[model samples]
Structure formats: C-alpha cells, structure tokens
Target: MILEEKKKKDEKNEKLQTDLCECYLLLNMWISSELLSICVPCLLKAASKKEESEDTRKEVEMALLALCNLRFIKIEQELYLNEIKEIIQHHQEYHNLTRLAYQSAWRFLVSRLWDDNSLEKVIVVEQHFAREAARELEELSKSVDWKKNKKGGERKEKEEMITTLRWMQTLSFFFGNCYLWNEEYVELFSSIVGVLRASRDNYREISEKCIYPFEEASGRRVVKIGSLWQSGAVDVALEEIHKSAKDDEIAAKILKFFMNVSRRLKEKKKDEIEEMKRKELKRKIFEKMEEEGYEDVVTSFHKTFDFLSNKYFFDDALSLDIFDYLVNV
Candidate 1:
C-alpha cells in the first residue's frame, strides 16, 4: 500500500513539472508576441491561482516575471529618448507590471545592453537594473537558507540561486556596456561597485569573472576624463558630470568631488598632482557609495526627476511621493 502511494506521488510530481514547462514555453512565446501586455495579467493570475508544488509555483512565477520584464524593456526602448515626464505618465499605469518585470527584465536588459556597443541609448539602464537586482538579492538573502540541504532540497535552492545570479550577471554586462560607449558611464561604474559590495562570496566571484571587463573599460575612460579636466577642459568635465548625475547621488558626489579637485588643480599648478588627488577622491567616493548601496535611492530620484521634468508635475509628484514612502520604509 505504501509503495503504491509513493508511486502515485511521483506521478503527480512529474505532471506538475510538465505543467510548469508548458507555462514557461507559453510565456517565452508571449514575450515575443504583440499580446504580451494583455497576456501578462492573465499569466500572473494563473500563476497566483494555480495549485502546484513549490517548484511548479516558482517556475510559474519566474515565467510571469520574465514576461513582465520583456514588456517594460519594450516600453523603455520606445521611450528611451522621451522626456522623463512622459515616461513616468505611462509608467504610472504600468507600475505594478514594472515592479514585477524588474525582477527578471532588469537583469536581462542589462546583460543585453552591455554586449551591444552600437546602441547609443542611455547608460543608466544598466545602473538601474543592477541596483534593482542587488536589492532583490539582498531581500532574498534575508529569507533563504544559504547552508547545504538534504536530498532534493539543496538542488531546488541552488536552482533558484542560480536564476538570481544569472540576472545579476546580466546587470553586470550592461555596466560594461556603459563603459564601452563613453567611459563616462559613472552610473554603471557606481552600480558595479554597489553590487560587488553587497554580493556574497559566490556571487562576487561569478560577477568578477563575467563582468570585470566593463569595469576595466570604464577605468580607462576615467583616466581620459581626468586628463581632459587638467587641460582646462571644463566643458568636458561638465559633460562627464551631467552623464554621471543621471545617478542622482553619484552625480551629486561626483560634482562635489570635481569642484574640489578642479579648485585644487588650479592652485597646485601641477596636473599630475591634481590627477593623483582626484583619483584618490574618486576611489573613496565609489567605496562609500558601494558600502552604503545608495544606488537603490536612484529609483526614487528617477520618479522625481521624471515628475519635475514633465508638465503634469503636481500629479506625478504626488504619486511619486506615495511610492517613495512605501518603498523606503
């Protein structure tokens, strides 16, 4: 009797796996379809409503998350150059979807964006996504068991962790992409620092192996920027500052650092001396940002920046205020 019951349970588990696989296939097809925005809510409902094993439930959730990410990326690609205000207006209606999508899409977009140097879109995409991934990982760490488990337990946990790490590596790729474009990808640079600081030993090791090239590329750019600034290239400095400011806190700190360094350079009359001081300062600032994980604050700034830059400032500002309060606490 016991043997028969075990056999029946095994069959049920196999069926659950089959169902989850079907859902994932459907999701992948839906992502590339015009019906993605429409199909997503239905999938989310199904994922929530379905009676399945833990593995099956997680698979469904992952599918839903991936679809959500694809939809947001589509929207981002369409509105990449539009005013922040316009993006926010459309984003408000889709905020729930955006949050869900960020879990999967942010990492994927960062990975893809980093690899393609031909695309001249904003570099902040990588920073935003990486920061979000780090945040999610941090939350996951707070809940999950990191130690080895018995039998099927360890495999299941490892699968989930691997999925999460894949997303992190994706974010790292975009960080590299930012450096590829102008080397002034300070937001990307800062985000990479943040992720490295927040990540566990295994995640850190993997990210370094996969994503360190972009960091190297950005380092080269920083050198060029320093040289230009020494040659009285205030305009170049300002441009770099603007691009970096896309990260809000990083921007503010970089601007302040630049102002101080430029002042010292003028007084010292030695470009090499000024460069040394500035490099040290840059290192310290990046370390501080990484240790504090201030990249997470950029999301709130994005909403506000979008609001202030738009015509519907009042409405958007109020909505963002509510969002900030909820997210920060």
Candidate 2:
C-alpha cells in the first residue's frame, strides 16, 4: 500500500511539472507573437496558482511583467503615444516592473525619434535601467554559492549556466552583426564570462573522479576520461579480479590529476600559444581515443567540439542538447 501511494504521488508531481512547462511554453510563444494581453492573463493566473512553489510563481510573474512592458510598447506605437505619456505621468505601474521592462520602453522610445531629434531623454532612461540590471545581476551572481548550489541543488545548475551563456553569445553575435556594440552590452559579456568561469569550476568538482590524464610515448599529454561512472577504471578492475588492482588505480589517479591540470590551463589562457596548445591537446585526445578503439567516443567529442565552436562564433539558435551537455558532462 505504501509503495502504491508513493507511485501515485510521483505521478501527480510529474503531471504538475508537465502542466507548468506547457503553460510557460505557451506564454513564451504568445510574447513572441506580440500577443502580450493574452499571455499576461495566463501568466498572472500561473503566478497566482497555489500549487506551485515560490520560485515558480516568481518566474511566472517576471514573464508576465516583461510581457506587460512589451504590450505597452506595441500599444503605444500602434495607438496611444499621447495616452502613454499621460499614464507614465500619473502611474507608477508604468515605471516599476523590472529593469528589463524599463530598458525595453526606452528602446521603443528611441526607435521612434528621428535622427534630427536629440536623444537626451532616451539616453537617460537607457542608462538608468541598464545600470540597474547590471548591478542586480552582479550582486546576485556574487551572493549565490553558484558552484556548490549548481552541484547539489534540485535545479540543474550546469544546464542553466550553459543556457545563460548561449543566450549571451547570441546577444553578442547580434550586436556584432548590427555593428552596435555598446558599453552596456560589454558589461553583460563580462558577467557571462564570470558565470562561465564559475560553471567550469563546478564541473571540475562534480566530475573529478571520472577524469584521467597521462603523457603518452610521443611526449604529448593524453587525457582518458570516462563518459559515465561504470565505463571507467573501477569497472575494468572489477572484471580483472585476479590481477593486482593497486597499480591500475594509481595510474588512474595520476591521469586524473593531469587531466585536471590540462583543463585548468586551457581555461586560463588568453594568448596564441595557449590557443595552439588547446588545439594540440584536443588532437592528442582524439588520437588517443582512436588508439583505444573508442571510435564512438571520438565522434561524440568532435560533434560537441564543433557544436560549441559554431555557437561561439555564429549567430545561430542553440540546441536544447547544449543545455544537457553542459549540465551533465
């Protein structure tokens, strides 16, 4: 009876999660379509729902508020510029949703002005909100135990970090495409780099046991890491029950240490030599994998490397698998 009850409870939780995810997806789609009035009501309902946690509710509220700002822009452009001025003159709601809302409003206003028009008003608005958002993100990033929380929390920290990185990369790509780099965007990029550095540290900690590094006969460094726990040294030793396992375990430990060093070195570099060395390291890794007959592993590694390389340099939409890869691997 207890087991049956537990199973039922698990099913109920799954159902609730699925429902919430569907609602969020619809909300995002509606926002993209400029149907903010429709999206806001649904999001507000979700935000007020008693079944969800505070975090989930807050997330929904933020989405609704963002949509409200977009709606204001759309309506102002289409119908009510004069009315919007009067509303802003009288109502705090027109002013205080979030920094993102304020920025969006400023952008909408600036985009309306002719080149001959002075940008003093719009520039003031933009500077105020951009600074506010930057301060908030910076404080939040600093205060959070990002590494530990990312490793142990119910929410997958690695995936969230990767998603955030990809979003920043996309923003940078768009800015470059439009020849519109600005100080505010540069600060955003710096914040992303900080987040990525934190995530890299977390990945190292969580996957410490699985990595191995060694110098091959060619004097090049080779890293042999397990993709999953069972495929590593522990399982091999289990199979070879008669052999002395101490030597193999020691070798694995040494290799793991070297692997960690290689990763850290690559992460810390800013010069051409370091870039060349990173490529050389990747080449050596594939060569070693091929020698070990791990062709599938080599293929997967190439695919991941290529995917990230494209994501870094191109203005393309990222795959959902990028999130899974970053968080899990």
Best by TM-score: 1
Against the true structure, candidate 2 has what lDDT?
Answer: 0.35
Across 86-198, the per-residue lDDT of candidate 1 in tens digits comes to 22233333443233334443443343343354343443433343334445555545444543334554343344455545554554444435543433433334443434334
Where does candidate 2 stray beyond 4 Å?
Answer: 1-133, 149-178, 203-329
lDDT of candidate 2 over 1-329, digit per residue (tens): 22232247434453344344335543453333333333333333443333335565445344433433332233323232333333233223333333332333333333333221333343334343234334444654565565464435566554333333323332322222222223453344344334434544554331221111111101122212221111233222222222212234333332223333334334434788867765565555435434554433223443344444343332223233322212111
Query: Which prediction has the highest lDDT against the true structure?
Result: 1
TM-score of each: 0.36, 0.32
lDDT of each: 0.39, 0.35
